[model samples]
Target: MFLWRALRSEGFPFVKKILLFALPTRLGGALGVQVILAALAPPGQAMLAEDFHRVLLSRALPAAVDGPDAAPAPEPLPSPGVPPTRLDELRKHVSKSALGMEIGPFHRPICPKREGFNCLTVDILPRDQLLQAYAEDKDVIPFQEHIEEVDVLLSSGLFASVAAYTQGQEARVQKAEGSLSYLISSHNFEHLPDPIAFLDDAATLLADGGFLTMAIPVGSRCFDCFRPLSTTGQLIDAHTSGRVKTTLGAIFDQSASAATHSGGQTIGDRNYDVAQVAVDACGGMIDESSFGALQFTHEFGHSGGIHSFVFNPYSFLLIIEDLQACGFLPLLRVQEVIDRPGQEFIVHIVKISEASRSPLPLDAARRTELLRQAIAYYIDDLNATRQLQNSP
Candidate 1:
């Protein structure tokens, strides 16, 4: 009974075939007949059971492997999320419904129709003058001419009143205040002799919930790479003294460090020729002696219109905080700062009322440290992006 059960359970078809064929041929007589009968008791039933077992085993054990103990392979892991590019990150922060004004949008306005931002673009030059300049050199325009149809709003007329920075709190307020929700100044802050005053005026121009979005070039990354970072103290002194002209020291530093590039291109794209230009502008070898006899004649030609202020992200934040501490009216609060790969960093500031201005929350040292950390993170991300692009 046990033998019969084992044969049936194991589906031993080969054993049955051997018993039926070999025994009948080798042992011819009663013994061979008895052996065949035992192997396949009910011959028709044995044949049917063998066929069914063969089909069932073939379908049940489908996998091909060395043994039952072998483990199955693991599935592949998912890819990591790609980090956002500098421009992509910047675009995410841009407001859509905000009614704002962009300054010095020569041709390519930062806030365009495609962005759905209700922004009015104004340049230092009038509409006709800007068009004439564009005709001479198309390269002067950075991106698309989104601001071509925008009316020519002069910088001087944008404010209600104009006074020197030294005049204090009164000059910070505007005469013709608008109901603007925001203000944008791209690559325009460095050109101003007094950035604090400009910022103060901008704050005054904005409505209660308004903000100012600005992009300023970092000295270490732009054409001003060779120039020393402007200190907060120097900016404070310049504003207090009410100096409109660029200092002799500033001019010398700029000329000495001025980067040279081929043809007409933005300052950001230019390569710095620090070695040659530094020696020439600084008189022989570059040293403190070069600035000793330098006079402020305001005769530096076209270079005069270049950067009046040079800063890195750290220094810029320092200056902004210091200005706030100096009791500049209308209170401009730093909302966001984005460090870009090229030459500039973008800062977004909101205007708060005088009542809200008192008891400033930010500690300058801690804030500066935080900004430095943020800048480092941005640099790492940018480097990683470049490495990924250059891979293979």
Candidate 2:
């Protein structure tokens, strides 16, 4: 080894590097062990040349054999995206426990004015449903034309004129202190060219975190149903102007015009599908998982079926599912069915919040299952409707 080292250092440039590694490694096992020992344990009187030879030999180790730090702990693989686990986190936060409030007016569809129930009674049409409920009290506040004043308004041939008047009244009440809720007409949306802009204005009018309740026809379920020219005209104008942001429940048969004079584009026939509208308009602004069935037909002395998407539980379930998909936290507490005295149903109630994710307690598998079930239900319901239409 000493002779080999001397030859290596004495200007043997051609064989220097190769001999340094091969000589030590290729030595017989006994010599290899000896060389290793000598390199690891420098003698007290070790020569400078010996030390230099040992230092030069150490760097021949492979990178795989190097220290952990030297190899670079593989840069931690980056995240794929917002993980599924994170979406579940949002769901937990979206649960009912997240909200704090009593859901409905004490006597819904009953004039809150009479019982002084600190809640708003929402109606989609000029119906005296609530007024009649509290007529004994005569505490009616004639802010706008409800069904109580529908006859009067109709007699004046000024039904459309009352929409603006009601919007103003709702705006005023929304601004008032202790205003529990705001009522709106479904027709008002059909009347306005831009429902979103109108809703934004209403949101502004509301108390911060206050309630907003309104119904809309989901899609073009009505076929050749006659509606007033003004009503259809408003919708057409909106469509032409590009203000129609939703197609969930728009009238598809608007061309038939047979129903135009009679409000042909009305949402009826147990298929007035507006799931998409609820999602687009209310999902972001409200909690969708909180929705269920508000199934009471106590108002209007009959089923307050006006604007009801369908007259059954399944219809509501589909709607709630849509709301959930749209990221709203839904809370369905009431289940009153119209014209069905013995049957109980839940009302769909969702709260608006600052959060954008779902608050329901569901895993990814369960959520996907829910989506599947909803789609299946839609297919069945649509097929059933078609069968009914074609039946003798």
Window of ten residues with lowest summed lDDT in model 1: 55-64
Model 1, residue 63: displacement in angstroms?
A: 64
Residues 149-258, candidate 2, lDDT per residue (tens digit)?
22112111122222333456433232222232332332233334343334344433333333333332322233222222122233335535755232223322132121
User: Compared to the true structure, candidate 2 yields what TM-score?
Assistant: 0.29
Q: Which stretches of candidate 2 lie over 4 Å from their true place?
A: 1-191, 218-221, 224-379, 386-392
Q: Model-by-model lDDT, in order?
A: 0.53, 0.30
Q: Which whole-number lDDT from 0 to 100 does residue 225 have in model 1?
A: 54
Candidate 1 per-residue C-alpha lDDT over 283-318 given as tens digits, one digit per residue, 9 for 90 to 100: 455565655545524454333355788866556765
Please identify model 1 stretches exceeding 4 Å from their true place: 1-97, 113-116, 141-152, 155-158, 161-178, 245-248, 261-304, 361-392
Best by TM-score: 1
Summing lDDT over every window of 10 consecutive residues in candidate 2, give the lowest-scoring window.
333-342
lDDT of 2 at 48: 27
